[model samples]
Target: MSQNNDNSVLFGNGDELPSNASDNPHINQLIDGVGRRQVLAAGAALGTLAFLGSVMPGAAVAAEPAAKGLEKLHFRPRSKLPFTAIATNRLDSISVPTGYRATPFIPWGTPITGNYPAYLSDGSNSAQDQAEQLGMHHDGMHFFPIDAQRGGKKSDHGLLVLNHEYIDAPLLHPNGPTLVAGKRSSAEEVRKEINAHGVSVVEVRRGLNGEWAVLPSARNRRITGATPMQISGPARGHALLKTRYSPKGTATRGTLNNCSHGFTPWGTYLTCEENWAGYFASRDTDLPRELSRYGLRSSSRYGWDHLKGDEFERFDATRTTTTASADYRNEPNHFGWIVEIDPFAPESVPVKRTALGRFAHEGLVFAPVKSGRPVVCYSGDDSQNEYIYKYVSRDKYRPGRSNGRLLDEGTLYVARFDASGKGEWLALDIYDKKFQQACKAAGVSFADQGEVLINTRLAADVVGATKMDRPEWGAVNPDNGEVYFTLTNNSARTSVDAANPRPANAFGHIIRWRELCKDYAGRQFAWSLFMLAGPEADSIGPNGKPLTADNRLASPDGLWFDEEGRLWIQTDMSGSQLSSGPFGNNQMLVAEPRTGELKRFLVGPVGAEVTGITATPDFRTLFVNIQHPGEGSTATNLLSTWPDGPGQRPRSATVIITREDGRRLL
Candidate 1:
């Protein structure tokens, strides 16, 4: 769903309180003194010779001497970015540089599993058909090479796994959602919509003629809102997770609102649940802190609860028989987690790793894994003024021997960015005495570690984690182990801090940090703002100048780093901001981290947010997803007919972009 939509449902109404506690002192002094020090230090070398080639128009920045930590890492020679930056436009189509070719593939209704049903053009496909076809609104994805030994050169065949975030009900049905007396009436329509929200695993191969096609294989599968899954890790078998479907609290029925994703070294997919609270609602006067803290409302987004039967009634999430196991009140606790799926094992059930804590997980990114160190990862809660988190496994990673069990036993920590340009990872573990005292003083109570993780937001709040500006997607630099997270716009922010300096920030920014001594599991780190996203007027680039036409962007969302450490950033501007601002339709840009240069790589159609990026190992085939084109428009006042132009309805699809010369994309 667009961030600018009526999000009161996703985040509760005005009566709902903010996640961060009012007494937390961490917010009052984020970057106040530190930013001035860094700016003055950089100005000292402003007259030095330019070390990196100038890529921006009439722009050049002098190089500064290497500092401690990541700056001391060996720098490798990198080839200059090859293509010219494209101009921003509001056209309803994909745009790329002059030497690139883009082809749409695996759009919304393309069948890949089961009986291989064909997509019905008039939106007449049944709910069963949708279960067999590609789900809607593709987001975070990864391409796993079939030829494992080939390493970074295998690009011919692989498994493509992508997320189906949410559905636009009006576009999924023949005319619109069926309504009987102002409530959803068609069970098939609701079922079809539910079937469309999950992940799609398809086997794709590059043909001999330089084209790509979905190949029928046993690896292709669909995990929808109805797919059964096991709840693993700390919160497993907890009373808060007990439901009629899983009386033991060891399992759940489905995964929903999967936005961004991650992949484990042991070869598993981690699909994150974001904005899932809006799907379930309650008619009760009071709701559990687990649901209420995560923004549960009295009304639902799609009204899935309006239907009868256990399958549909679970969405209500209200107390019926007083016992948690007898009703679906614990249903909300089953979501807001990182679910692990074995893509190669088609029949294996997905597991929700609760040790990673619960919140509106935008995505998860792992640090460069080492043979003997703990498996470490970072995640961001994608909401206004939420907190960023890191999870460090208690078990050591033993190369091929490592598995999702490493995630099952871990210590989750919330970030606390201080005013001295450094940060600390505050443990949310129940055993931590500091955290225990903080909870006691705040009048919050937790019975065990599982409760601490299940109520992670409240735990972070009492311990004074720094509230950020809508942290979204995160990426780690492969060369130096520096972590970068995009803080998407937060217009609700009324106070300025070091990490989030702009009050009522409309254009979000990127913040990066290098772990102390390059230890991925270490608690201390140094951080700084990488880029402030906006028009040339108010934004700040890494070079300390305003954004130029070549790379103007806002609402930075999806982020990833290629094999060479080149950062690729995607934008997600919504509502009137997407079309009317200096920014055009959402775009994907490639950034040279060393030179602080950004070039627009691709742009999507009107009303679509360009997200979910992954590249072939050979760096030749780049797959990007364009989600929800013509989002708010209906059949009569159509706004876009993209990928299948002119007369057809707009369908979200993955565009495969390759260099015209059939060479490396960079």
Candidate 2:
């Protein structure tokens, strides 16, 4: 998972909840019934679940519901396993239900061209070889079926689009690149790194015996940072995006820091750009004015500025000269937007849809479309105390078949949570009075819609939207028409408020809302706290309110709902305090939304983030990505010996999880 923005501050210090409590009746009602009761029962249940040593890990067994609303597990022996027990010492094995098995499908740098040799991990691969091989740091992913006639067949194959985030330079380059007095050792080295940072589309199929493998077809394609992409929607051709490669400011050459993703209803891959800000650096003295606009407070931590070339120099947004044409002021503007790719059409140019307001986009979930009505999209800003936003396409989604052009136009709105439990979707338009006033106050002039979309964060702040704890992935419950977003933990969120009132939010919570009259494009909605993270003891009702064990989870990150309406929740935690101490490591949990029944399904090893979950229609097989294991440790002195072996270092890989009995995960 990606870190939130830098502006957020902790609400209160220590573990205690904030003292300035709300007098609202709804808060009191929640505290009285559901909150208090659930906490108590969850506390007792956690103790029992942790202490029940008889239930061996991976055994399928149903768990007795300590509270109502939570359904009993169908597999008694398997469901009883504690959430923490899923972590394993084995390098290439998955800890799943007893009957299940996990196969490592595509490891980092796997050959895709059928010509490149397997990854040796010694940094000897060439730029061409790396391009033909799988990119490093695999994050959000989705599996698309090639044949609709197969009826969700596991035996059928499809295309897999996986985001290749930043590369491990130290691991990828031999003896590390030799910086010649702050310049890159060679231009080829820069080329290699750029070519290694994007998305990979590989053809995959299942064998007759039900085994899944990559199909080395001619359609296999690798899109890297050098790949040309078009700018679309409101921000296309904006002056802010002007670059030598894209002099018209309507096109750019890549996506970086791709994180959690979403699949479009029209069958396109949505790859979010996270932590792209760290790739560039602007000198404090050289371009002070330009640096401020692009959010570059100082030189970047990654030090791409020292590369001494236009390709590397574009990362530096600082402008030494007064004119934008003379410097790279517009470079940063080209990035930080949701990039869409049609994996099926390898030749199609990827598009950066500006209709979706730009920021640190984490994920984009689409609501089921209604003909003649606008299509809705939910996205999280992925920063501490940042905001959650939605976009409603002006064009209606035509039924029967996808036209693929509907996404080109839309109105993006940021969310505002009111104390009355109502929420509003604030439109982000340059012409809006709120936005105009804000721009005037900031002493900035916008030429058109493009500027507003490019500078969306500033526009949203002017409207006073509710800030949340690093909102990440979002999922819509088809059964209830409720939208659920993961409020990944915020070290800065210390005090309670109407939206996020809790102090010291170690384990974050989930916020769910029902659109007015089930209209995805509606601006008004009713909202409620769906689940609270922390120890089970902390999430309970005061008196008669209903509660369930499923509500108690920590730092909710990746979220998805299977076809059966089973909600899968994944956790992401950082800092030694959260990762090592009381909270073990990140894990994946499963929940049934209607019943409010949730259970710990699986967990990742130390230093790994549980992310990118997708399932076949049958739910018999699942795919999850383990990202950046042992990431926090220094390369010289590692903290975790994961995927263990001599000379073995943590590498992000996708795990294929399936039930041993070939049963569904629910």
Candidate 3:
């Protein structure tokens, strides 16, 4: 069964409400700070596919005179996709094109630096052993090119950094989480699960035999839930962030639910915290609106809190202490930010740059930087009817090893897409009178700028940002710099609108926007749907004929654009598609940005998602992650064991897909 994103069910009373802007607040601020009306005006929604006629054009960006051909930047003609499309299938193993070969590499439990025991078929690895092994549920990733001269040339020898989204306890341990008479039975077991919830930086090399292998290097390290991270940017040093361990609010321990990733132009890796709120439990009856909005008040996603000891107890975010710095009540505040790590410098500590603004960050992809231009990164809040965001740096970018200065001192903007094919980037700044008035009207309590950054969702709501389906991974077209994001299926979508026309959006769609005048930091953007994911029988081109086999995909999740302008899209399916269906297994396909021609490049094994893709700058070698085969399986009944035969535990892994003839992909 493909996973359904339904947030209409109430979180309490067994029927949960997805934290949406359900209430209206009267604010005496300008629309987009234009000093017009204080009453929030609802942006019109795209009511039908007719809005797509001007899909790629920035029809609403105020007409500014431009250089010759600058007007055509947003009107680039679509090109033909160059790969042969593979038929969808329900095969238990991976499938690829005729000329391509897939080799599984660096699977979960592959020891990096420890004298750890080999993984046993019976799932009996000790918690201490798992600390040194690769974590589970690999998601978004990036390949940092190892330039010997450090001049940024593409190299096959580089660090392969990946986000271990979460752990599947049932598949990892002998039995599911050990419960003793309704409470967590073993503290050691809980420790092991915590150890498996962060990011991994592995050294990958292309051997003489034309294969990629996990090589041991000084940088080969695992950052588990127990690792300490520094808190930097606007939200740092705030009183609300104070906890027993980091009383100053300048530090925290570990990164959780790391989903997608970004590679900084200054040579650092960004592992995003997506869906991280569920890990901690909040017990405060009079919880702050931000905490309640994030849904941490619900029962812990995992019962890590039930275990004895502060090490585990800190995960319970309830304000049990009369004063700050006595417990982990603020633990949830430290997470859900874009965590920055220097993969090249193994000794350096990871930093959570709070200027990015916290929410459920999907992937953070930066627009290509030019000299003296403020660096910009685009991201999406991954929840039903949430919002998309972008962080524009205060300082222009400098090319060199990461000094850790760019992400700090930045303004975060929430997108408000207009139904008439235009969008405005609403700045989430207190200096903006509208933002201040909305905060006052919404009753959001924040002592300072740091508090506002910590509680970004509240700020977004106050700004009246556009609601969207589950926005997943994002990609920026290197050719035209158009920002693209995947709106993964939202089963709760009960009404049709311009952006999401399908009432029940089971088949996800991709949307793109051209920033006005091709400026990466432009506030005005022209937006439109790029393509809708669905079955071949229903798929069609603009001409209304059946789309090619390449376009017959559902639920776009992982996305990337090769250096040569080829867009590589990966699929994620849940519920029914896991076993048998039109889109049998999750897959990765290559497509043309303009022509919208799509062709299936590869399909994952049964019961797994195709995610975490990157490639050599030359595009000769493409790396992809096949995550959670036998994903929802149980200890007693295994559905489909993969990356190993049946009777062996299924393991998530990174696979290297290369052309067999030792040439760049044709």
Candidate 3, residues 145-263, lDDT tens digits: the string is 78723765655688889989887778778877777676677888888888887888888888788877777688788898888889999888888789999888899899988889898
Error of 2 at 81 (Å): 12
Give the TM-score (vs. native) of candidate 1: 0.94
- lDDT by residue (tens digit), candidate 2, 448-552: 888778877766766667777778889986554567898877665435554464655666777766666445787887665556677646652211123234334
Best by lDDT: 1
* lDDT digits (tens) for residues 1-666 of candidate 1: 366446444221111234454456534245443332233234222311111122111112212223444334455777767789999999999999998998999999999999999988678899999999999889999999886424535789999999999887777788978887768888999999999989999999998888999998999999999999999998999999999999999999889999999998887899999888888889889877887788787888788899999999899888989799999999989999999999889999999999999998999999878788899999998887689999999999997678899999989999998756667999999898989888889999999999998999989888888988878899987656668999888877666666676667888888887677544788888666677888888777765566899999998999999978788999988866776978999999988776677889998999998999998988889999999888775655568998788877788899999989999988
Ranking 1 against 3 by TM-score, winner:
1
Worst 10 residues of 3 by lDDT: 35-44
Clashing pairs in 1: 30-498, 31-498
Top candidate (TM-score): 1
Residue ranges of candidate 2 with Cα displaced over 4 Å: 2-93, 148-155, 175-186, 284-294, 320-323, 400-404, 433-445, 540-553, 577-579, 633-644
Q: For each of the candidates, give the backbone clash count.
A: 2, 36, 18
As for lDDT, the candidate ahead, 1 or 3, is 1
Off by over 4 Å in 3: 1-17, 23-80, 440-445, 537-550
